[model samples]
Target: MPELAEPIVIVSDVHLSARSNWASKLDRIRGLWQKAGTVVFNGDTLNLGLANRKEMCRQAIECIGQICQADGVRAVVLAGNADSILDGPRHLLLKGGRLLVLHGDVLFDSISPWRRSAKKLRAARDESLRKMPPRMRASIEGQQASVTEAIRIVHDRSGKRIRSRRRTFLENLVSLSWPRQILSILRAWRDAPGLAVNFMETYSPQANCLVMGHIHRSGIWHIGDRSVISTEGFEGPRKPGVAYVEGDSVTLRIARQTGASYQPGKVIGRVAL
Candidate 1:
């Protein structure tokens, strides 16, 4: 493997497929990749459920290969929940194991049935789809479609419930006692960062910083000396963000839409490892 250089840019949850307008977004990413010494794709570079998996994977690989061939640029690609069907490294250790980069899906494996099902489908499809007879392939595809539809229904209901609860919580927050408000805030904090902390403790305790993307929301949370940085996805209305690493410092750079193109805009957050 080639050694990655300093000032590495980490992006995740691209979710590239034939249906999405990802080519222009990728071109923007390529511009950023050219300026950085290394580029790390944190995961979900392809959406297996929404496209012809084999062809999408091939196209993704070809595009990434071109990026890697850029002068003085190195690429590290890791698999996410959607693209786990492909063979590649699932996680990376950097800065002598002080910093870890991962897709963040592992944290939800036990709690998210949708994620678990998707992972299983990817594995089964990858292992058998090509070798199976046409009838078997049709059967598997039918099952996958059913499962995906069920997941979509459940996800929609869950999202609505979550939004309602968030609104109720905010409305009640103003009337609550200071102690109760503090507790509510703490509980909210515990939801995502708690999962990240538990995951790191179990899998990569030596890591003081983690760069991950699975949840679309982007933010940073500090757990003592360990910090978790989550980046926004390319598919969302929110500007796509990257974690720019330089020596012991990491800065979050979100893309700014210029007149005709996107460019690295501002440092929204930073952390020292």
Candidate 2:
């Protein structure tokens, strides 16, 4: 029998928030956990910024550590928006060479969903007070709004703040119709530094693979001989979870449980790039 080499695996967006769907995928993670050459948390392992479920977030981090240590694979830990709540390293573990590990939220507008939600709710409440009975509205106005433009305005301000941090966020926004706040999300696989003026539209010509574990939209963008891939997640009922690849001959496989991990959880199955 031919000697079997360790398989390369990738995972990300393990949003351990109470609302996330990592239960089913984490149970199965042990199966793939035992085989890979490397395991990446890709970030957002905890709902660190969330208002509730501290215990759940803690469990998620512990579980990730357990899987990495048990498997004997080098674990790459990066920060997601959730992870940013604690304020430590932004990202860790790069690829083979000098590629830095990225949490992707650095490219984001805001790393704290809890904060963002709170502010929006506050703005909404204030706006609603403007319309309701002053007596009853006084209390509710302190919480959220009932109007549309108030929320929109608050969100718009958030985008401007996001652009201040990451140039990539602003640059990428030029391509989409999505809200500007999305631009602030720290990104995993940026446009490879100086590859192109348009990072999202650019691709590597000499690299084997450009790996990224954010966006949750799993698919590979190939340009010439280069390939860019977005890692799936364990947050929702999506396709093959987060993934990783090492070569061109390798093909990306979407597993039975690879949809929404939130940041970058490894619930994905990998064959080739």
Candidate 3:
């Protein structure tokens, strides 16, 4: 047998549900394994809780676990919002030599529950937005501000992210502390030196690649001599791949998704992503 190359493949946000079409995607995932010595299953592998829906989430999780543990290699996973209680708190994921894997939520301590996503971000969430008095909303939009920033200010000022969506929309309209409150928030903060590497900041105190998952965007950055990298979510029709590189190689490549690579049975595309 040919010697398998040691590769670190980072993958995240595979919100696999029972209904999701994932089997076909797994075929391409095979491309990662023959070369991978380490696999990073970043998080959100499950859809989460509902009396009626928990089963689907469970199946998704089981399927993901199976995929991660395959190929007789070790895999690391992080927690994600959709997995909620199962999102396994900080420190669940660790890689060698200054590589840190975290879900990126527990960093701030208080997290808006996963259930709140729809009510908060939905396009028709106007009643929730109406209370903001227009100008502050403009600021958030202006800075391309993170929703975490908006919610943090409201959370700190009134001790709530907003007042039941109905009343929260306007509470900030009258608060004098809005500006200061937004300034003070510790957005995406981590107490651990290794875990602190962000796409924008240095990866580790010693400085190496910092790999994280949570927002589900694929990215790479230079951290001193280190590289901070992330692979986008595999769920929701994203163009996803598990990347592999070897022997301190400078070149990295992403394989194309099988489904979109070809139309009606041509040939699956393979391109850098």
TM-scores vs. true structure, each candidate: 0.69, 0.49, 0.50
What would the per-residue lDDT of candidate 3 be over residues 1-273, giving only the tens digit for each residue?
A: 133335656566656555555555554464555546865565565544321265555555565557656666655554454454353333322333344454454332233223233234322233334555566544323111233333334334443434446555466465455454433333222222233343214223442554555644444555345554545555535444343434543222444555444111112221121
Could you tell me which residue pairs clash in candidate 3? Answer: 131-169, 131-170, 132-169, 163-168
Of 1 and 2, the candidate ahead on TM-score is 1
| lDDT of the structure predicted as candidate 1 | 0.67
True-vs-predicted CA distance for residue 154, candidate 1, Å? 15
> In model 2, which range of ten residues has the least summed lDDT?
196-205
Q: Per-prediction count of colliding residue pairs?
A: 0, 39, 4
Query: Could you tell which candidate, 1 or 3, scores higher by lDDT?
Result: 1
Q: After superposition, which runs of candidate 3 have C-alpha atoms over 4 Å from their true positions?
A: 1-5, 21-28, 49-56, 67-70, 87-96, 106-204, 223-226, 235-238, 241-252, 259-273
> What are the runs in model 1 whose C-alpha is more than 4 Å off?
20-23, 50-52, 111-190
Lowest-scoring 10 consecutive residues by lDDT in candidate 1? 109-118
Residue 168 in candidate 1 has what lDDT?
62
Pairs in steric clash, model 1: none
The CA lDDT of each predicted structure is: 0.67, 0.47, 0.44
Residue 237, candidate 2: C-alpha displacement in angstroms = 3.8
